[model samples]
Target: MVHSRVSINIDSWKKVSKANKDQIFKEIHHDYAVEDNIKKPLLKKLGKMHRDWRNRLRSGF
Candidate 1:
């Protein structure tokens, strides 16, 4: 059997204020699934979360 490990940056989330965290969670929850049936996969290298993080900070995602 093969096991996979997933890691999240808790410190980063801790830095954000409660209100901002709520907003971020709401945004993420709503957009969790795309309206379009076709699904987009995250980049194999930087991964999905990082791509989303960068897009949120910058314009033109």
Candidate 2:
């Protein structure tokens, strides 16, 4: 079976879904304070993605 698309081009930072925004914050929170979590590296990656996404919106993508 074919899976539906998971992400779409967001035209603006304000347009990004709350779920996606929360996902980023959760990753950052997990990295800085969560106990026993082994995915710290993902924090940087997620942050970069979030920043890049906002940049893309600022660039009028």
Candidate 3:
């Protein structure tokens, strides 16, 4: 059995205000923009696969 540990520094996070959270979200959104470009194509492919599966199920195949 493997155990994973999860620890959070609540005091440090509590020090962050709404402004800090907004700035962090802005930075994350910017980073996600880059990843989203790469992910878009993969997501489209997956969507197609999902549609195909749904169609097959509907057709009783």
TM-score, structure 2 vs. true: 0.41
Model 3, poorest ten-residue lDDT window?
3-12
Worst 10 residues of 1 by lDDT: 37-46
Model 2 alpha-carbon drift over 4 Å, by segment? 1-38
lDDT tens readout by residue for model 3, 10-41: 23445469787677556544556667667556
Of the two candidates 1 and 2, the one with more favorable TM-score, higher being better, is 2
**Residue 28 CA error for candidate 1 (Å)?**
1.0
- Order of candidate numbers by TM-score, starting with the best: 3, 2, 1
lDDT of 1: 0.51
lDDT of 2 at 57: 78
List the global CA lDDT of all models: 0.51, 0.57, 0.56
CA deviation > 4 Å runs, candidate 3: 1-34
* TM-score per model over all chains: 0.36, 0.41, 0.41
Q: What's the CA RMSD of model 3 in angstroms?
A: 18.2
For residue 22, model 3's alpha carbon misses the true position, in angstroms, by 24
Q: List the residue pairs that clash in candidate 2.
A: none
